[model samples]
Target: MSSKSSSQFSTFKDCLARRLISTTDLDGPEGSDDPLDEFTSYLASEVWPALPDTLYTASYESLSSDTVLQEMASDPFYISLDAIPIPTSFFDTLTSYTHFEDAHDCIRFLRKVLSDYLTEATAPPPVWKQTRGEKCEICERGWVRLTYHHLIPRSVHGKVLKRKWHTESMLNSVAWLCRPCHSAVHHVASNEDLARYFYTVDLLLERDDIQAWKKYASKQK
Candidate 1:
């Protein structure tokens, strides 16, 4: 148990140190460079011990790691789930969660995070950047049609507004993309997660999956 625990914690810390990985994308407190560290530390110490020993029928003593997650899940705003240990449950696809839980889980989670969420390196641009209609920003392939997609998905607008940091216009932000790349984005993440995280082109491009898809799309007709 000790060896496994040490390995798990180290894997998490290494992922946190990545250049492409950002704390803001993880829904960490704003301006925090060490969000995961602080987040997990809180979970390990404070939250783990604070859960009620008994809830309805379940019994939780001293709030161990096992019990805290169950408590957190029940809380509407538990400050989000653990990103450390890299959650396979967060993903939705043809494959089962267990498919990603092997030795590959760590890198797979990093790839998932980079593709699915948005991070900030600077402030939002002064004006709305129009989604390109003449061509697709992601790929060189000529298309029969170009679609304008919400740079920040509209479905999550209601949730995003609750935060009060972004304007409605920002939520309605658009980006022109080819059919394949457009589909790619939606597949990579759910609408609400995208709105909560990615709202910019740079953040979109930084995704490893998007980068890979763009490379393939560029070569196609």
Candidate 2:
């Protein structure tokens, strides 16, 4: 990486570290320092090097053309049901635990319930819509055609797999965004960046360019 890019990355890493410390309660008996240390280490060892040049330079045609979308859809990286480890009998196990054996069993049951609740709570919201006239999720503009944007871009599924940060099920998630918002995303960030960081409508909307685009798109036909 160039010196400028490296410097920018360091600044970004520091900013992220501060934000994580302030905004998230990663503290435990092990202490808050460990989480901050681990996060900074992860950014240095894993995230910074994986960023792609295309994120800064990709054109709308490269990002939005039907050809590109079709290629991504046809890529063989899709996570099949067989690859997932959930046993077919897992739900049966849940059903069988009708009575608690002791305090430990009660704690286990409550833990499971809490785990399931958190999973359901943090899992990305569904973005697919059957109709075309609904307001755009990104800009909240009404009466516009919204397109389905793969949260983790299909084009970068291979990179995502290589990084081991996400699974096939996560890659298949999508968001409904307006044309300008969608275009601005690809314009500002590469497929790899999308897979790693900006993989949600909320994250994409945080970008300065996307925020500007949303303001502009909200005023258009």
TM-score of every prediction relative to native: 0.40, 0.44
Pairs that clash in candidate 2: 55-190
Instruction: Compute the lDDT for candidate 1.
Output: 0.51
Question: lDDT: which candidate is best?
Answer: 2
Q: Per-residue alpha-carbon lDDT of model 1 for 44-138, expressed as tens digits? A: 33222222323112212222434543443344233232433423332321023124334355344444432221111112333445535577877
Off by over 4 Å in 2: 1-133
Stretches off by above 4 angstroms in model 1 are: 1-131, 142-144
- Candidate 2 lDDT score at position 128: 40
* True-structure RMSD, every candidate: 17.5, 16.0
Error of 2 at 23 (Å): 32
lDDT of 2 by residue, 1-221 (tens): 76445544555455445544554453422445666666454533443343333222222223344443333234322212233333323323223333334444423432333233223322443434443347788779877777877879888898898987675556677777777777777888888888899887788878888888888877887
Which candidate number would show the highest TM-score if scored against the true structure? 2
